[model samples]
Each structure stands twice: as structure tokens, then as C-alpha cells.
Target: MSTSKLFDSYKLGPITLSNRTVMAPLTRNRAVAGFVPNPLSVEYYAQRASAGLLITEASQISQQGQGYQDTPGIYTQEQVAGWKKVTDAVHAKGGHIFIQLWHVGRISHSSLQPNGGKPVAPSAIAAKGKTYVNNGFADVSEPRALELSEIPGLIEDYRVAAKNAIAAGFDGVEIHAANGYLLEQFARDSTNKRTDEYGGSIENRARLILEVTKAVVKEIGAERTGIRISPVTPANDCGPDSDPKKLFDYIVDGLSAEKLVYLHVVEGATGGPRDVAPFDYAELRKRFKGTYIGNNGYDLALANKALAADEADLIAFGKPFIANPDLVARLKAGAELNKPDQATFYGGGVKGYTDYPTLAEVKQAAE
Candidate 1:
């Protein structure tokens, strides 16, 4: 398979992708009241429906999973109806989308948790960051360490969320085990100090992640399940694992058994220096033995190189998709890429969200 080109179609499990360009899950914080996907979200996602696969922004499995303000959830009937509209719009545009299930763990503020409960995690440590709330950033609240008995309930949350995603009409679902979230906290030893079956060794630290993966897979077949892992990403403050290669190699090896559709990996720190740590993507890839979508700072040339080298089956683009709705076409034609406006990247009223033009519009403006 000569995978240098982005326009080539590829079979990803049950569905065929039009191209290898994947729109990575990005948090736009545009959900309406009740944490439901809004009409604006429908337009926002439909605009970039050209991707081979569209992974929606991390949707909280429960209110306790929410870390940011106005982020959508898949926990309620209203939320499911809202996502149905978003997924329907994407399908109508001839695209495939996966909902990313997330839990913020210690990276959340009390205001974001249900009834102002302290965010829960594998340990009581607090993440060194601020969570966006009501148009401003608030200090993250310290979390309560999960009692051994609570593990079952947390895993059930993921299972229910997977079912909700299917009910909401998503073609598949991605478990967000990456980037300093709940799953990652359990996987990383930096914050997890529990001395039980869920912590201590690499396997124990990764217990929750693998358990959640298995539960979700049971609810929505392994073929419809994918997971993202950030081995060394220090973003949101739950990273720089004590032994990233050991921890992730164990994770990748364990994941090989679940028969997951794909394993999304951020080569290094999430959107940070590639050499921030000593972890190796090649090593992790070799252990996984499945479809891999490599992410973090991939451009056309890098993506092409990775594809040609068999480094990744698919390449996920994040910030680039924000500024270029027709990312696939632009990469194919080698056109000038639009610069993204950082001010409007987080919260906004469709300025940087859906206002980006397509390739044709860019060509016309120049003419």
C-alpha cells in the first residue's frame, strides 16, 4: 500500500474512508444549555465533513466527566437528540464520525462537576492548570482519590456513554485515554499513589484504561471502538510519566489483545516539543499491531512521510482543520494554508469556528 497521498481511500474496519486525512477530536466548547450539541455545532462539523474520519470533540460520559464550560455530553436524552442532529448532518455530507468519550479527572473545577463535587481521580493530586468556565479560566479543584469500590461505577460510565453514542447515531466511538484526563491519570504514576490493584506497577496503573476499553468494547463491538493515548504528553499537567516507554509499551501490548479498531497516539507531548521525552513512536507502534492514527503537529509533508514509511495508517490533523475546512483538497493541491486565529479558537460565535472558507473560496478570493 503506497500511502504517501492523502486522497487515497482506505478501508477502516466496517467503513471505507474517502481519504486518509482524519479530523482529530477538538474541543470547540460550543454546546448549548443542558450540554447539548447545538445547531451551530451541526454547521461547524458539516463544514469539515470531507475528512476520512471526523472525531467529535471529547463528549463527557457523565456530568462528572465534564471539565470545561459548555462542552457537550452524551449522558442525557436531550444530549443524545442534539448529537443525532450533528451526526446526521455529517452523514448527509458523506462522512464518518466518532464521538470521543472523555473524563477530565483532576483537571476540572468544582463548578464543572455535578453538585459541585470535587473531581475524582486515581489519586487526590490536583492538576497544575486552569479549566475554562463561563468565559474565564478557574483554578482546578483538588480531586478525591477513587475508592476501590468506585472503579466499577466509573467503568460503567464509559459503557453507558458508548451506548449513548450509538443511540446518537455516531458510526463509532473513541475512548479519550490521552492528554491528562481521567484515564491518563490512572495510567500515569506521577499523580496516582494508590497501593492497590489499580496502581503501583505499570500494569496496575493501566488497569482502569484497559478495563474501560473492555467495557466499552463489550457495549459497542471492538471494531467500533478506538482509543487515544498520550504516552508522554504533559499537557493539562498529568504527564511526563515516570517510565513512559515501559508504561505505554505495556498499554500497547495489552491493547493488542482487545482487537480495537485503531489506537490514536500523540508521538510526544500533545502539540509540544517532539523531543520533550525519550518515548519512541516506532516502539509503541510495533507493540500495538493494529490501525494507528498518529497525531500532534502533523503537516502535509510529515503526514506523507509517516504514511509512506508505514508509521501511521491515518494522520490526524487538529489546529489545521480549524482554519481550513477543505483540508483534504488543500493538501492534495499543495495550496497555501490559512492561518488559524487563536483568539477565537476556544469560545466564540462561529467567527473562527465555521467562518473558514473552502479551497474554492480561497481560490476565488485570490482571483
Candidate 2:
């Protein structure tokens, strides 16, 4: 029964959120066989159904799009069936859910790729990072540059994934253009050395993501399509852009033109400092005319402050939601949160995934 704007309902595109808190997409890397969502995921997400919106862990659009081991995918009927249960469980509790569509590009190892082939990226240059594969972290395989002919097929993959998400009963889908993934790889010049139509100039570099966004919007409606972007994050060896402000401003402008439902922006580094670089986030906010979701390192105070200042329409909390299934209730009551176990974060069973006790449970135990 808090009076803060953080507890208020929000109208996002076509749907109304119960509160302004969003559970950000967190990769647990716990998919079962055929890259389907782990059966436990339904319970895991249902436990967190009190959030205003729950964005599922980044699900690969196709086998070629996978990077980390054991993460879920959305391309096949089996995978769609797995997610339907998750969506159904979330909806039964009066919650809204969106699935994040992902393509990891060069952030993958050959073992995770189709036929043990090389991962694909905007260019052939290898990212100086590692991906979890075969239950261990290994250096990302050197990627082959995507042929221009392959671009259409890639966009098609996103479109089909969006369609699959809807079929799986997701309220919407968030294109994962953030965190140096496939789309980000194309958008950032540091990783995109292609001299083709998709490289060099800012517009050229921005083409692939824009096109993918357009395709997803076309497949689904714009009101059902949102996107996530991390402008300056050096995650997965995506080097700093020459002019991040200019680049993201142009990108945001294009996304605004598409009239996306919301623009989820990761402020500063992915999981690191907020002031990792100085880029005016307000500019992107001004450019995009839809709901704005602010993410990364946000606590209750910051969320309240951002909403009060009208900096964001919603606040997406990552790790907090992991250990606190009842995050909104805990925040409303100002209760202590359960700390997440880092040891079992990546790939695991239900211990770290769904066993976190809620505040009410803790209170009952104490009593």
C-alpha cells in the first residue's frame, strides 16, 4: 500500500501493467533437451508473477542464433509448447509476460552452433570473450561474416520467432538488440568491419537492427513489439563506438519512426557501473515516443527517483527479481531481500532457480 509512483499502474502500448516494475530478461542457461525451456521455468516465472511485466530469458530464434549452452529457443513446436506453459502460468496470476528474442552472433562456441559450424556475425573478427558451452566457459569461436544474402534469412528468423512467441501465448516479444548480441554486433562499428551495405556509415551499421525491428513489428503489431538496446556497454568485447551519442540517437530515431511499444535502455554497462561512459540517455528518451523502460543497477530509490523525474515509464530490475520472487511485494513492504546464489546462476537445477523464499514465507518461518 505504498503511495510511490513505482507502485502505480502503467499503460504500456495496448496493455496495462499492474505496477511499474519490470522483471528484466535474465539468462539462466538452464534449458532442457531440444533447447526447450526447462520445465522448472514455468514455476520459476510463475513465482515472480507479481512483477508488472516479466521478460523471459533471451531465447534464441534458431539454432544458429544460440550462444550460451542450455538457453531456450523459440523456433520449434516443442519449444513453443514449453513457453506456453510459462505464459499460461503467469497469466493465471494476472501478470503480463514478454519473451526476449535473441541471436548471439559471435558470442558463441562452435559446439553450440549448427553442425559444429562457425558462429556468424556482422564480420569475421573474433570477439575477445567466452561463452558457456559443454558445461564450461570457452573462448568464443571465430565467426564468419554473414553474407548479404543471409541478411534476409536472419530477419526472417526474427519474424518467425515473433510469430512463435505469440503462438506460445506471450503478451509480446522484446527484440534483444542489447548487450553486444547479434543485432548489437551489427549496430556497433567496432565489431562490424563489413564494407558492404550493412557496414561503415552509422545508417549502414544501423540497418540490420532497424530491418529486424521492422520485420518483427510487421509480423506482430507494433503495439506488441518492443526492443532492448545497450548503447555503450562493452559486454562481450563490443568496443566503444566512436560517437555513441550520435549512433544511438540515430538508432533511436529510427526505432521511434517504427513506433515500437517500448524502448528498454540499459543505462551504462550491462552489469557494471552506471557512469561507465557519458552518453545522454535523455536524448534517446526524447527520440522514442513510446514507453521507456530503464534498466541496470536500479534499486528501489533509483526506481522511485526515475519515475518521479519522468525519466522512465517503467523500471526493469534484474538480479533483485532472481532471489526475490515476490519483489514488488517486498519493495512495497520495504522488507529485506533474499540474496541470489552466484554459484548456481548460469546453469542449474531448482535450488538457485526457484527455491528462494519469499518475505511472507520467511515471516511465517520466524513466527
Candidate 3:
């Protein structure tokens, strides 16, 4: 228990991590107007530079891909320059960072989209929920179903975003294919109602993700690329398939052919409704041959167990990393963790962002 397998270093493509503890991408909604990262973001990430690998908050790949206000983007010159400050800060602390390129699909409101247009999705279905916007929460609009011909443009957005991430000085890029995003919408049968080559059968449903990954790997070598998948998650108003295992099996198999750097899988929501379903995390670990990062509700003990049992090559901690900037150090020393302030999680200043103390500060307090 004292010496955990999670503490071991592992090679992720061309980069070597100090350990297997990864900081999961978390949206803080603290970006400036026009979705540009600010100096505060630079400070926020640099403070957590001890994580083995840091996956930045999901960043929009295009204007149409944006689902919320103040979330950073990667497709523009200003945004790329903005993110460079963040990457530079993390690298200065000797940390490796990956930008997670995202497209929200149906989980969006018109206020967050271009020209006040409807959100775009695999189908014109409306997410049965509300979305956070600049003002506050708003009902999701009926999304416009993308045409068959329009698919390539979306794929190209991801490719260009990967290139932009590299230009921003990111060590790599992770395709945000999970958590009910655009790619997940296509992967799940319930959301994708198309009869064309991109829908219906498992292979067809998984085609867009494969194409996007191929394009990204082609744009930037496969060694500098990673993908994330949430097989059974119903977050962000995503619908489930009749057979999730069959769908994901084909998806993972297709991605394996690319020989990408790693696959980050969210088994289910840690404490949400999705956690009620039965899932096989161990099976997913076996299915993905590359480095596997397991996310959701994992503590230091569970992370160690997963690593020792070969259930995951790495562990991604979300909220824990939010409050504890020195998450890796705390995990290694078995120190008490800082409780995250849910009130300040979404949109905030320095209160819950970069003010958390490291173990050194706490120990000094006692003395």
C-alpha cells in the first residue's frame, strides 16, 4: 500500500511521464471573451504541474463546436496564442500537457453558437436538458442534423485543431470523443439516426471517430495523439445503444489500428445516474492495447489497485485535481486531500482555482 504501482513511470508515445497520475480535463469557464485563455488559466495549470500528464479542459475546435460561453478555443490565432501562455507555464514546471479538442454537438444553445444558429448534431434531436451559457443556464435548442457532405468539414476542424495545439506548444492532443460530445453522438445509435455510411451498424456508427482520428494522426504523427471514449456514459444528453459492448468493441478495434498514444476511458459517471449501470472496466483495459487511462471516482487506493491489477496504465483524477494543485505529491505521500468547492467549480476567479495549498504549506501550518 505504501509503494503503489501507480507511482511508476510509463511511456506515452514519444513522452515519458513521471508517474501514472493524470489530471483529467475540467472546464472552469474562466476563459476571456472570445474564448481565449488568460493569465489566470496559466497560473491555474502551472500550479498543478506535478501531475504526470495534464489534459487541458475541453477546447472548441471551431466556432460551431462551441457549446458554452468562455470555454477556450483552438482554431483561431488569438486563442492559440492565448493557450501558448498556459503550455509555456506548465512546461516551465517540467510538466507535459495535452490539449483536448472538443465539439459539443447537440449539447449547446444558440447563444453559444455562431450567428445565433441552432446547435449541430448527428441528428436534429434536442438535448433534454439545459446548457450553461454566458448569462446563465438556458434550455438546449433543437440541433440541426448535419448533412452527409458536411461531415468532412467537421473532421477537418479536429485536424486543424490538433495542428493548432502543436503550434500552441502542447506536447500532444487528445480527441475529446467521450462524454456525449459530437463523436460520441455519432458512436451511439440513439443519437445518430442516419442511414448513410456513417450510421446504423457498429462499424458505420464508429466511422466518424475513425476518420477524425486518422486525419489527426495524419496531421500530427500518431505518437503525439490520444483519444478518449465513454462507452456507456449518457452525459450531456447522450442516448445509449441497445448493445454498448458491441458498439465500443468495434470503435476500440478501429482506433487500435491507428496505433495512437493512449486511450482515456470514462467507465461511467463517478456518482451520477450513469453509475447505476453495469460496466466492465477490466474488459475495456484488455481491449485497448495502448496506454489506458481510467477515469471517474478513482482515489489513491483504487488507482493503485487498477494499476496493479492491470485494469489501467494510468488514472485520471478530475475534481480532486481541481482543489489539490499538487495532486501527485499528495497521492504519493498519502496526505489528506483538499475538498473541492462545487460552488466555485464552473465559473470563477482565484477562489477555488489556484488558491489551494500544497502539503508543504499544511505541514508548515502545524509547526
What RMSD does each model have against the real structure?
Answer: 1.7, 0.7, 1.4
Q: Best candidate per lDDT, number?
A: 2
Off by over 4 Å in 2: none
Candidate 3 global Cα RMSD: 1.4
Clashing pairs in 1: none
Worst 10 residues of 2 by lDDT: 1-10
Which residues of candidate 3, in runs, are more than 4 Å off? 270-275
Tell me model 3's lDDT, rounded to 2 decimals: 0.88
Question: Any runs in candidate 1 off by more than 4 Å, and if so which?
Answer: 1-3, 365-367
Give the per-residue lDDT digits (tens) of candidate 2, residues 18-107. 999999999999999999999999999999999999999999999999999899999999999999999999999999999999999999
Tens-digit per-residue lDDT, 162-264, candidate 3: 9999999999999999988899999898899988898888888899999999999999998999999988887877878889888888888888889988999
**CA lDDT of each prediction against the hidden true structure:** 0.90, 0.94, 0.88
Instruction: Tell me how far the alpha carbon of residue 23 in candidate 3 is from the true structure, in angstroms, after superposition.
Output: 0.1
After TM-score superposition, the amount by which residue 285's alpha carbon in candidate 2 deviates from its true location, in angstroms, is 0.7
Candidate 2: clashing pairs of residues = none
Worst 10 residues of 3 by lDDT: 269-278
